[model samples]
Every structure is written in structure tokens, then in C-alpha cells.
Target: MSLFRKPQPITVIALRDAPDLVTSLRRALETATDAERPGLERALALTEDVAERPDAELRGRWVRRHLDAAGYEGPADSVNAIRVLRQAEPGLTLLQALTYARETAAAENTPL
Candidate 1:
């Protein structure tokens, strides 16, 4: 058997189900300009990538990088990001949700 194996997918829930979270994301995205939005977009993409491989350690790494690039210092900042995204696109995916959570947790000054 091969020593390496594929990582498991990260299960994620829909943003619509989490109305409060959706609102939060929308607000966060609003603060940035179109040029600066790429960081948030990349963060969202990383979330989708991690969801496809939830168990992979790389997921966390990517999330942290994206969070920093997006100017999120902690959970509160992430909350703001989510709010911005939600306001921009109500139909955002679950991957976005997972990404937001991971970034928020990493950004948090205290242990979550």
C-alpha cells in the first residue's frame, strides 16, 4: 500500500442557515476596495480547497496567510470580513463559512 493517502474533505454548512454569520461576513468585505478584495477572495478559495481536504494541515496554513493578507487580526476582524461578504453576496458558499471560522480562530488573541 502507498504510504501517502488522500486527505478527507471538510464538511461545511451553508451560510444562509447561519443568518447572523452571513450578516457579519457581508460587513467585513465592505471595508476593502476591489483591488484589496483579492485577499479575501483568496481566503475564500483556500477554504474551498481545505474543505476538499479538511484533514490536511496545509488548510490551516493557507487560512492563516489569507487572514493576515485580508487584514484580519482576530475573530472580531474575521467576523467583520464575513459580514462584508454576506452583504456583497448573500449566496456565498459553505466553504466561505469554514474559511471565515478558521481565519477568525487563528486571528483570535486568546485561545478559542
Candidate 2:
């Protein structure tokens, strides 16, 4: 233990998928970097809200907005940002974040 330091509070969000169904994704989230796990959850909440729309442009725009909010943006078509967002938000699974953000995506966030 560090005598001169304290641990920061991490926001961990559990998933609602069958444990076996999302075993891999669950482990990924569990072992993800402290910065990543919650960020991914945030992205999922954003994706779930508007993923079924027929508006491709709107989705893209929303993705951009979320990226900005999550501080995940970089150069145009940032591969890193896309990779994180996809993995964080049910990219290859049917899981859902349990602790959904209280406010909708349009609301301001306190920097996760």
C-alpha cells in the first residue's frame, strides 16, 4: 500500500447478459484498463439510444459527439477511438450496461 496515496473511485457497470453468453465480453470489461471500462459503458449507453435509426449520417454524427464527450477523439477516422467505442458498447455481444447514465446523451456529463 502507498502510504502517501489514495485510490480513486472507479465507476464499474455490470452487464445484464447471461453470464455464459457474454463471458468473453464480461471478462474484457473486467480486465479493461481503468480508463477504458467505464468509457466503454458510456459508449454503449450512447449507442443503445440511437442505434436502430435509419439515419446513417445521424449515427455518425452521434458517434462523433460521444467521442468528443468521452475524450476519445483523435485524427479523422481515428482507429483507436472506433476500436474502443465498439468494444465498449456491445460490438460483438448482446450485453447491456446495468448502470445506465441517469441523463440522456443530450445532457452534459461530469467527465467519466
lDDT of 1: 0.51
TM-score of candidate 2 on Cα atoms, chains taken together: 0.29
Candidate 1 TM-score over all chains jointly: 0.29
Model 2 scores a C-alpha lDDT of: 0.45
Worst 10 residues of 2 by lDDT: 93-102
| Superposed model 2: Cα runs more than 4 Å off | 1-54, 92-112
- Give the Å shift of residue 32 in candidate 2: 55
Candidate 2 lDDT tens digits, 1-112: 5655654432333233433434455556777898888976665555555444334334445455656677775642445655544456643221111112212232323254
Each prediction's TM-score versus the true structure: 0.29, 0.29
Q: What does candidate 1's lDDT look like per residue over 34-111, in tens digits? A: 886887666555554544533323434444555566666655335665654444445554456456555545544545
